[model samples]
Target: MASSNMNIPSGYVSSASSPDWLNKGDNAWQMTAATVVALQSVPGLVILYGSIVKKKWAVNSAFMALYAFAAVWLCWVTWAFNMSFGEKLLPFWGKAKPALGQKFLIRQAELPATAHYHKGGSVVETAMSEPFFPMATMVYFQCVFAAITLILLAGSLLGRMNIRAWMLFVPLWLTFSYTVGCFSVWGGGFLFQWGVIDFCGGYVIHLSSGVAGFTAAYWVGPRSSKDRERFPPNNVLMTLTGAGLLWIGWAGFNGGGPYAANVVSSMAVLNTNICAATSLLVWTCLDVIFFKKPSVIGAVQGMITGLVCITPGAGLVQGWASIVMGILSGSIPWYTMMVVHKRSALLQKVDDTLGVIHTHAVAGFLGAALTGLFAEPTLCNLFLPVTNSRGGFYGGVGGYQFVKQIVGALFIIGWNVVATTIICLVIRLFVPLRMPEEELTIGDDAVHGEEAYALWGDGEKYDITKHGWLSDETNHDNNKVPSGVTQMV
Candidate 1:
């Protein structure tokens, strides 16, 4: 029998039938944290993409995000959640099922048998631990992770992608690709059994997104020549605001990975902040030295790389280790994006709109590798029953951990590369990946029927049609041409 008071205080007690304050508090925090993450993908990433893309593609890119946000939720509740976290269907995947029944939602649960088992002495046959929160919370929390993964993939196919093709791709990829990755590592599949240490989503989320995004970009083809020649971010401030949200929202991102508020959560939060800050500082210094001017955009990219690099090790490394990871993440990705990407003909041909390949994929892999180098046995002890061992530098476990990290990362990268390529090729056979040439010419307005900014100052609104600037008769002036029409040269 399970101990009911596993998380509750010993001295004070409440009826099991009645809800406990602590449980309620945990649920609230988890839900809020999940919401914060959801925001990062929706308005946060949506706005960021809108501002970062050339003006013509802003609405289309933002709409892609919005569509994914809504589409994934439906797929998540209906089936994708179970396929990723449900009972194992195979060593590398799980069975797909709907988990939204009222009874299923009401039941309390624990981590599945496939999840990491730390408390028991025998790792080979340890029993699964149960969770305190209702199944509803677990389903919702995992949904956010799934949704964001698809959103991240959107970054690679932006600018010229047809909305219709994306709509089909999101669910198809979620079912075929995303579920396998989630199940293998997180849902107690083969990777978990192999002792792969992904504290959060270094492999499942970032690595998978990065690889899939880069590959999809190749298959989808590049943006128009004109669009690529002068593709400047229309609104840098909006991108900055999204960057701010991403930084703070990571508190939930890494902190909540432990599934409870505890010392590991605290450590994860602190380490995340340290790595991100250090990365930003390092990148800014590099920018000043190279370009003779510090670029805010460069700083934000550094921050993102730092965050991505630290995510896999957030709960497994010490404060000092985090600083090292930050520096490496900042410097390495910077070199890849600036020096290597410019020189590499392969990368130049593949138009990744947000550079997700470098920022998330390369940085995510680097972080995971660093985790092997720096994981503190003490930190692992806090969550799992594994004995604490020093990393390569600490002289305890020389090259074993590093080897394990490489194995895990390669598994993810290779799988995504193969699976994503096949998925895109098949999808492209039926639905075209790129928008029609005429639609591409007019951009977002012709496709999505929307624009990101109106720029009406001080509550002033202008009717473009009423000015006789367009051919619409409803807006034509019956008496004469509108004032500003002839004023223009």
Candidate 2:
């Protein structure tokens, strides 16, 4: 963070020391943290999406994520960042403006005005974003979050969504649904003023994605019956590889939340790992006890839920509380996915391909609610300036914060459901949300004119005599093609 090196010319003053506002170490960490988070979306979700679905659906699934990453970045600088962090226009939103001008991008970043917010009648405390970096760094960091939220939602529609619809849906959802949550929780909007805590993005990212994904799934409808019945992963190893990236990459996710290289960032990173590990182990144990065989997929789901669960309180709660959150995140979501989903018509009706509803929605809500119970006053003080904002266990106004958490979630849930529905409906007018029957039956080969895997020898077929799925004549859903040699780069 200090500047003493002799890299400057005799007359030239380097930014390394000229601007007193910049902290070299902090800026470096923030940018690196943002890069790590971006990895979670690109190759992380991309690989996971491709490997977790059946062979035929792999390319489309991965492409959705890859495309979202680029699209969100373009839209982000053009206007979405300002919509998230610019001056407040609506109580729950910021004014839309481009963040692309060099003057704006080069300047130091700042939180929105700290003055009280107002309704038709009164004023309240809005949350603030005071990161110590240039506008370019802040914009890049937030864009990754926006991109990943869309990718997570893609998990729900991987096999059935029309690729064109998905391309459109990404921006629409980011514009309306995603920006709303970002403003509310992190960008100094209504919920922030109301003291609804979301240390990272348990609510803004996970809950919103979960609810929106489920709603979109309902609107787009389920996959073909045969696919719904037997959509086994094409490659569990690759799934694990992606899961590993998501797991380790989260250190950057929460670490960057504090927006500086500090104690809070360290705690957040530690809590993230603790919660995820406990959740993974607890989920594995339940599988062994109940199913008599531990399932890798179930473990990955638990890992994700743990990561989501601790996000709201990552730096706010104690280490022990992270363990408790992980246990509940693992067990409750597990039960919901296993028992209740099978029993509830509503859950059964929506085909959440990866059980995103359980892992994200259920666990995210649980984390937010628990943050109200376990948030330590001292820790709370470090993260935010809210008065009397400790959790219920701390015994003050904290219980009220619990109610606020639920209400805040209700608002987020309500907004995402309605917004996602509207976006899908609008996109439907121009493009069918679901793939046509022929495309659905043929999967990626029909939609993308490509497959996730192909033979080393040939193009049209996989060599019927040796490798499987050799003929174009094979029925995709029924064909038992051997998993192809991965074209991993």
lDDT for residue 278 in candidate 1, whole number 0-100:
96
Top candidate, metric TM-score? 2
Residue-level lDDT of model 2, residues 1-489, one tens digit each, is 236556656344546433656666788999999999999998999999999998888888999999999999998988899888888888788899999898888777886743445431255543445566787889988899999999998888889998999989988899998998998777878788778999999999999999999999999999988899988999999999999999999998999998899999999999999999999999999999999999999899989999999999999999999999999998999999999999999999999998888889999999999999999999998887475579998888988989989999999999999999899899999999998998888788788877777544344454435555345554343233346544321
Clashing pairs in 1: 109-131, 110-130, 110-131, 114-188, 377-388
Cα lDDT computed for each candidate against the true fold? 0.80, 0.87
Model 1 stretches with alpha carbons more than 4 Å out: 1-22, 115-126, 385-390, 455-468, 471-489
- Candidate 1 structure quality by residue, lDDT tens digits, 1-489: 358768777644656533453376567677877888888887888888888887667888888888998999999899988788888889888887898798887667555646444533355444454556677888888888888888888988888887888988899889888988888777777787666778889999999999999988888888888777767888889989978888888888888787777789899999999999999999899999989999998999999999999999899898999999999988999999989999999999999978999999999999988988888877876764235534565666636767877898999999888988898888889999888887777676568555455433221223455532332222221223345533110
Q: Model 2: number of clashes?
A: 1
